[model samples]
Target: MLNLKQIVAGYGPAQVLHGVSLDVPRGRVSALLGANGAGKTTLMRVLAGLVRPQSGSVEHEGREITALPAPRRVGLGIAMSPEGRMVFPTLTVEENLQLGAIHARARRGYRERREEMYALFPRLAERRRQTAGSMSGGEQQMLAIARALMARPDVLLLDEPTLGLAPVMVKQIFEVVQRLKEGGLTMFIAEQNVRQTLEIADHAYVLENGRVQLEGSGAALINDAGVRRAYLGM
Candidate 1:
């Protein structure tokens, strides 16, 4: 449902993504696997409209969205769960999620969507009034995902949702990802855990040195010689 073509982007003058082209087919989980500094996060931000591309095009469903601002992107059904969770530490979980629906177009039925988020994340229902910072890392990550879901997104961008979590938490988060996939959510996930990401994704792209090095079906990528040598460590 989303297509990025030659996405050249960076912070200020240092370009971090070079001709990074990939496609996220509708209702499928697309994983971008890479080590640190591979521009995975940069690519996610570009899709979210948080970072502008120097020269490239971003399209959703067939139309170009290269120049839309972040809110417009949200309005257009794109939501991001950032790498660090980025939950408002001072605010309650429900408040944080509610704030996410404040985009101009979402004011109507905001309360209804908030209830939907709580339903999707039952654990969030119990902790709705608790401060985000008081929650565990995994819970904070859930809050991030829940907050993004509050926007009622058609596509979700997940950036390192398992970073620094315990093994059990990682499994739980991946389970949530699986559930979302089964329920037909389109997602682009930038992840360090190649095995887990590949397991959940339909297709995968390997990013190296700020560019796409290889792309294929997730299972195929898991067995690729170069990917095994560098990423899977086989």
Candidate 2:
């Protein structure tokens, strides 16, 4: 499980998150829903240890990791697939995946784990030797998620995994998320596609202006009059 309490972070003088708090239960998908600039991405970065919080704390399974570095967080079973699907342009699909196994624990069974990833994403298997830059956006996004899985994380942080993808590709991505959830992966997804995200998420939190505005079960939030009106356009 992951927990954040009163996390305040910012870039220099421009503060983004203000007294944000949330919990991610083990083996469940927790969705963070917000429009742009709501500090969703910043929250993700804070969890991943990329951005040090100015106040409060981040804990995983009761261990404080507020000051831990990014690599150490990855070693602690935290892996993040960032917003833009930032795959290596010149690296082959296989190489990109291999890069994710930087931690010793992940590298122990690298080959077998990679095969599992390939099985989960057959398309990547087909283009194992292809350069990442040559792949389509959907393919690249798949590669991005696959690469993160290569770290063999216990909790995966996905920031806008479906951003800018085609509707069909978005559906495919969500299906993958659903499968991960079924397999008992603990995930914290920051997404804008409210309807689909709530469908697959166990719990949901709505962020507005860098703070939690609402938090509830996925279905409850989906059926909420305000959520329906603002996010679902109903």
Candidate 3:
């Protein structure tokens, strides 16, 4: 339900994405796979309205939103859980969730939504009053995703959700993503973990040097010689 066309974006004069284009169909998981500096994160930022594109357009459902501000995009059902799990260290778990629902639309059923998030993440429920800073990296990542879900977004942008986490944690995080997919959440995930990502992705794109190098159905790409050689070492 989201589309990007020839999107060129960057910070200052260093352009990262060179006319990158992709589509995220409704109720499907779209994976953007690349190693470091492939413009994966930049593209996610552009989609989230955190970075204004120098050219091209971003359309959601059918409406152009390239010029819209980040907060406005959030109001339009776009929520991003950034790369670093940037949670408020000083805030309690529940408080961070409260901040996520600050927007009027999300605030409508805050209590019920919080409970839903808690159900999705029982660990958070147990540590509801604990400060975010003291949590483990895995727990922090869970909090980041949970906080974004608090907004009740239509499409969730998950950027490197498993970055730097333990192997077990990575598995858990992917399981959570799988559950979200089963529940019909439209997601655009930027990740380096190819195997697990492709396992759940409906469509996948391989990005390199700020452009799409390959795009195909997840199942198709998984067996692709190029993909296996380059990423899976098959």
* TM-score of structure candidate 3: 0.99
Model 2: per-residue lDDT, tens digit, 75-176? 889999999999999999999999999788699999999999999889999999999999999999999999999999999999999999999999999999
lDDT of 1 by residue, 18-100 (tens): 99889998999999999899999999999999999999999999999999999899999899999999999999998998888
TM-score winner between 1 and 3, please give it.
3
- Residue 84, candidate 2: alpha-carbon lDDT: 96
- CA-lDDT, candidates in order: 0.91, 0.95, 0.95
RMSD of each: 1.3, 0.7, 0.7
Model 3, residue pairs in steric clash: none
* Per-residue lDDT of model 3, residues 1-234, tens digit only: 899999999999999999998999999999999979999999999999988999999999989999999998889999999999999999999999999999877999999999999999999999999999999999999999999999999999999999999999999999999999999999999988899999999999999999999999999999999999999989
Q: Which ten residues in a row have the lowest lDDT in candidate 2?
A: 100-109
- Per-candidate TM-score against the hidden true structure: 0.96, 0.99, 0.99
Which residue ranges in model 2 land beyond 4 Å of their true spot?
Answer: none
In terms of lDDT, the poorest run of 10 residues in model 3 is 99-108
Clashing pairs in 1: none
**Whose TM-score is higher: candidate 1's or candidate 2's?**
2
- Candidate 2 local Cα displacement, residue 184, angstroms: 0.6
lDDT of 2 at 52: 94
Off by over 4 Å in 1: none
